[model samples]
Target: MSIELLTLCLILSVFLVFVTGLPVAFSLGSVSMLFTIFLWGPHSLQLITHAALGSMTSFMLVAIPLFILMGNILERSGLAETLFKMVYLWMGPVKGGLAIGTVVICTAMAAMVGVIGAGIVTMGVIALPSMLRRGYNKELAMGAIMAGGALGALIPPSVAMILYSSLGKLSIGKMFLGGIIPGLILSFLYMAFIWIKCYLNPSAGPALSSEETVTWRQKFAALRDSILPMALIVLVLGSIFIGAATPTEASAVGAFGAFLTTVFYRKFSWRMLKEACFRTLKLFSMVMWILIGASCFSRFYMAMGAADLVKGLVTGSGINPWLIIIGMQISLIVLGMLMEDYAIIMIAAPIYIPIVTALGFDPLWFGILFIINMQIAVLTPPYGFALFYMKGLSNEITMAQLYRSIIPFVPLQAVGLVLVMIFPKIALWLPGLMFE
Candidate 1:
């Protein structure tokens, strides 16, 4: 078969695997292996071996494990719980305060962990029950959880930034810096919306009773608990943007700092450390496998002139670049409903990255944009993972209710997405200043 035809077949096979519920790593690896043998005869096996080694061996990819380790460590160390508590003590009593607090916590967690599941699942487990228990509107509570959790991808030190850096051959430091402002803007927008919604309806998110409110002294005391975690976030992100450390190096610093913080708080037991290490290895392996598959897959596409085909398709078409970007976001929103966000990224990024770059946009800018869309996707109705994660968190909250829940947050997310697009500066400014 022709290479293009073979690639087409490989793509279909991978899609079938996804539909059949196989793991993404297995789906990609199995299909790629099958097609490699078919296309290159017996020699195809050599390509997989080479690609696997190359993918794992690359220095840029080393950030994956360390970042994963960082996420796992923070998750195990009750970072989310502490953050939620710290924010909740103040925000929780106000109308929509819990919801806003959830977003705040998610934003901070995203900077710390950079993993979607870590943020969503962690918050869902810790915050969902409290929000629901307090008579917060189900949709409001669930939407906030789903949307907030997904913000980790757009923010600095995010796994998406690391992956983007590796794939685009851009500076991880620059990508990290690029994501900082955009992430914060979107986060602020989401929280601001939640606050307003709570203020207007008071029904959407009722304030806590007088007894629920913490005193000024109590709030101040609570802020003290936040100093270590906040310091770690600043140290990791600040070091990167300031050019003192690469993302990998920052990840190391973050991990060590997280460990010490956990140890000082007496939360760092050997069991927790061992499990964190194991989970990190497992998550890291999953991402690396897809990266390897993608790297190998790109070889085929490059050989088939896929990049050229994409360039011609985009440039030759009469469509505007901004429209094309919106279209990509729409497609990601749809795909997010059907595919896992990570898988969606793996499948679409290679094709989309070239197209976006060819349109004269910065890859780091596009990376932040892409991640914001993914954040929306994770909350979008029907198949958003965050919705499902929240559904599992609260039995009283049904799937239909969960789907209904994100109505307000979705528009808020769309607002954030549009704002970032209109002022690419939100995504680009920090990276520019950092590099300059």
Candidate 2:
């Protein structure tokens, strides 16, 4: 069969399996196995073994589970609640203070833990109810939590960025640094929208009543509780920025610091530690299996000459490179609706990275831009992980309402994505300043 025909068959088969509700890891692995046996004979099954082994043995990937453990530990230890309380108390006097404070707390959480699940669930459980009880608009309140929770994917220590960096052969440290400015930009944009919207429409987020106010002494007490946790964030991120540690080493320090913070808060127990370890293993296992499956699929994809076919078409099209980049971003948004970030990165990065490099664009910049799109994908309707997480947390909120809430934040995310694209320096500048 022709290479094009084989590629079409493989892609269609994979899509059909996914549509049938087979797990992503199994779908990719099974499809790759069938193709390998048919095309390369049964003796060639060792290719799958080698690919899985190689991906699992990657040294940088060690950071993923450790960072996950760190996030899980802090989460179980009540760090999110404490941070929310601190920010809410401080910002409560301002218009739309609760919403603004939620965003700020999410940003801090992102700096500490680079996954969205813990932050979203924590904030959803804690801040969402508070906002609702205080006469805040449900859509505005939900939007802030979902959007802010999604920030963890864009911020440093991000496991998603780690996977992309490792696969794309970009520097993890540089990718981590590149994400900072853009993440903060998007975060600030969310805060700005909340402030302005509430300012214009007082009914959306009213200022707290005098009876709800905390004395200056009470505010100081709140600040005191948060100091150690804030310092933990600085210790982890600061160590990476100052050249004191590699990302993997920094992850270890983060995990240890999170445990110590729990001890300080007196929230530590044997059960808490066991739960953190168990959750880490579950999440880690899922991520690694997908990585192994995607590796097998990509190996078969190359064997089938799909990468070459794409290179030829892209290089021969004579189209503007920028247009191709835009097209790639659009495809990511569409595919993101159907797939998780890891699956999307695994399938697309191998095909797209070479094209990006061929066009003389910086891969690191494109990686940051891609991460921003993933943030938006998580909040989008019908299949967004964040939207489902919101619904699961609050039975009172309908799926339609959750979808409606995220609509406004979508464009704000795009604006951030465009800014990074138009001025690559926004992503590159911090990394360059630190490393170059």
Residue-wise lDDT of candidate 1 within 105-126, one digit each (tens)?
Answer: 8888888888877887888888
| Poorly placed runs, candidate 2 (over 4 Å) | none
How much lDDT does candidate 1 score?
A: 0.79
Among all candidates shown, the one with the greatest lDDT: 2
Question: How many clashes does each candidate structure show, in the order listed?
Answer: 1, 0
Task: Name the weakest run of 10 consecutive residues (lDDT summed) in model 2.
Answer: 376-385
Pairs of colliding residues, candidate 2:
none
User: Per-candidate TM vs. native?
Assistant: 0.92, 0.98
CA lDDT of each prediction against the hidden true structure: 0.79, 0.91
Predictions: Cα RMSD each = 2.3, 1.1
lDDT of 2 by residue, 1-436 (tens): 9888898899899999999999888899999999999999999999988888999999999999999999999988888899888888899888899999999999988888788887899899999999999999999999999999999999988989999998899889899999999999999999999999999998899988899868898888989999998898889988888899999999999999999999989999999999999999998899998999999998888877877888887889999999999999999999878788778888888888888988889999999988998898898766689988888996899987888899889999999999999999999999999997
Q: What is the lDDT of residue 196 in candidate 2?
A: 99
